[model samples]
Target: MAATIRFLTARGVPVMAHVGLTPQAVNTFGGYRVQGLGDDAERIRRDAGAVTEAGAFSVVLEKVPEPLARAITAEIAIPTIGIGASPACDGQILVVDDVLGMFTEFRPKFVKRYAELGSEAEAAIGAYADDVRERRFPAAEHVYATASKAGDVA
Candidate 1:
């Protein structure tokens, strides 16, 4: 990861390093486990340092312990972005779907739903369907006047 970050940065590409609870490596880690816990703190610390030294402008710490996240943030010169990490990090990130309560396949422990837009959307569509079925839609006020040829209208 550090090597890739370095290569990208060397080519003038801004790199955002991702540490802890890497979703892509979920299989290797045996599931979505929080990283930087207990003895793993040292490893995570090293990872953060390596990433920063590799020229990453920011790093996302996911599902790491709050204290470890704080320490990593302090040790690194770049900004630390937390996902499931801690509020002490420099910043935070969340998926738009998670925030809007649209994607419900599985909810992470850290995600906080701000709105139930999915349910609202479904209700709205059902209402529209009912209106159309009852012939109550396309009411005169909801339609446009047909175009008239020149001089055809008085």
Candidate 2:
């Protein structure tokens, strides 16, 4: 993360670090629960400090204890985007696919579904299959004879 930040900043790009309840740490967190994030808050504090020190322009806190998230955000010089962290944070982000309901089987607690893309796509595919089975497809322009009067080539 430090190396990536340095590389990006060198080229004038701003990088953001992610801390707390990181989905990559899902197994470690014992599955998508808000991190209690301890009273000492040392780990979160250190995380914020390191990201800022490493020259990241911002950091994100996801599903962390609200107080800890606020404290880290307050102490850190850069912005702290939050997801299920709290409104006190500088910004928020949501996964596009999740919000669009691409995966109806799973929905994160923080996301507000805007549409059922999964059902729509499934219905569309089902319709296409029905059309194919009913010989409703290949209307004129959709198919052509491979055979020619001169010869049938393989």
lDDT of 1 at 5: 90
Q: Give candidate 1 misplaced runs (Cα > 4 Å).
A: 120-154
TM-score of predicted structure 2: 0.74
Predicted candidate 2 versus true structure: per-residue lDDT over 1-154, tens digit per residue: 6677777888998888988777887998688877745653687778778878888989988877778888888898999998888887999888889778988888767788888899898899999999899999867666555545666443
Each prediction's Cα lDDT score? Answer: 0.90, 0.81
Model 1 has an lDDT value of 0.90
Pairs clashing within candidate 2: none
Q: Per-candidate RMSD vs. true structure? A: 5.7, 5.9
Candidate 2's C-alpha runs over 4 A off are 7-13, 129-154
lDDT of 2: 0.81
